[model samples]
Target: MAAAFLSRPVYPGLALVPQARRHIFALEGAGAGALTDLAPDAGALTRSDILYLPRDPDGAAQAVALAALGAASLWQAPDLAALLSRLAGLLDGARMGTRLYAAGSEGFIGQVLVVAEAAGIDPLSVATEHRGNRARRVQCVHCKTVAEEVTTQPCACPGCGLTLFVRDHYSRRLGAFQGVCIDAEEPGSAPAAEEAFR
Candidate 1:
């Protein structure tokens, strides 16, 4: 269906941990009862970064729950834009041993992967869980400006003001889907627009 084509990009390299180490904590083992004594809003990881979007109640709950379950260190991001901004500073002095746990909508998860890749964090040290669907990241092909969680096609490119048609092709490197000007060949002409993307 059209929805399948409108899905977000998948970066295989960013998602997998090719080298699994025994010494490193297995994310699967971080069960609910692991570190219950700890507080939900404890703080940022002493040796890592626990990033989540505060706007997503589910993500916020998961972030706090993870902290309570021994993820003890945490940093709550007000939003994705703010987290992307602070991540640079967080990684500047971070050690190779530092880990990252991310949970949120696909758009948020994807962008987190972008930041993680940029930070040079090993895939082995990262874990992600999807909290929701129905959101997507749309990148402006003309300008590379990414519009987060765009819910409609033929929408105006946030960066260049072009009417973008969300294409099936997705670019993992960009963490967004391919978008082309619907009226590129013929100005003022376009396909019938849908109500919106869920």
Candidate 2:
């Protein structure tokens, strides 16, 4: 099961990608396996600005912080904090009327909401659900050489051969929910169900 959400103010369309090196640089001395190899699709995330955050250790913190700095708008791949800090930062800087799209784990969404509230930024809305389909095996964020199955436990990257962990999983449902594009047949369609069932 997965969840997604669409934010208000409808941001200008711009591609946004995370930069692995920048995140690893930020986590210098924090650990050896700081960066993770992004998926090929993730790597091809062009036509948009990219900002990388570590996928191991406490990568969520940095991801959230970077997301909060989004000037065009904020969109996350369904991890914890949903990059709320980046969204907030964008809002704080100017009243550009940006939109936010977040997807990933439910816990991550909650964390983002909490942080947003604390920062005095109100999300347009939220939706919660489970990730759809099976999780894919991906390269270790730290080493960027080895491929491994997705797991909650920590493992080492095969390339650089550094220890790594599944910091956060991406979610499409969260993005749909934030974007208010979730389908009625979707698992987290209870809100829509109410229209008929109630």
Candidate 3:
């Protein structure tokens, strides 16, 4: 069992909510594969709308595969912002009995949960599956700056210039992991950053 950090998210992977009348998928990068892997039935596919954002160039292929699923609609967002914007719009007009699924890196899923919350949806109710890129979004405790795609343990704060030690702790409201100064006890003694969450 994963450690039950009060705020840390635990992904249970994507499963079809059979009773749902409609389905919405917010997918990022290789995360699109999760849906394809599910092989939703024809009835589910006909009622599904997908919002996909490629994490990198390779994401184009995943987008293509998701398109072939024959979903009711598949939108390839140019960026995360575009995906979120479209998601917000869809949520605003969402009818009852709609189920949401999100998949991707931790950072990507965090942002998706934030959007879901803004739409008055319970973030916990959304199905999630962690996919490519374990890189995290870190927020500096001292400076309150959130950095995207942080892959190291001791990372430099882009906002306050602090050498922050990223922690496993996560914040659902902020959609980021906690980062604290690593050299606070002994200034300039922080260890060199090494890849930890690629």
Best by TM-score: 3
lDDT of 3 by residue, 2-102 (tens): 26777788999999998899999999988998999999999999999999998677887888899899999999898889999999999999999999999
- TM-score-sorted candidate list, best first: 3, 1, 2
lDDT of each: 0.55, 0.32, 0.93
Per-candidate TM equals 0.63, 0.27, 0.96
The 10-residue segment with the lowest total lDDT in model 3: 1-10
CA RMSD of all predictions: 6.7, 17.3, 1.3
Off by over 4 Å in 3: none
What's the TM for model 3? 0.96
Q: Against the hidden true structure, what lDDT does model 3 obtain?
A: 0.93
The number of clashing residue pairs in model 1 is 3
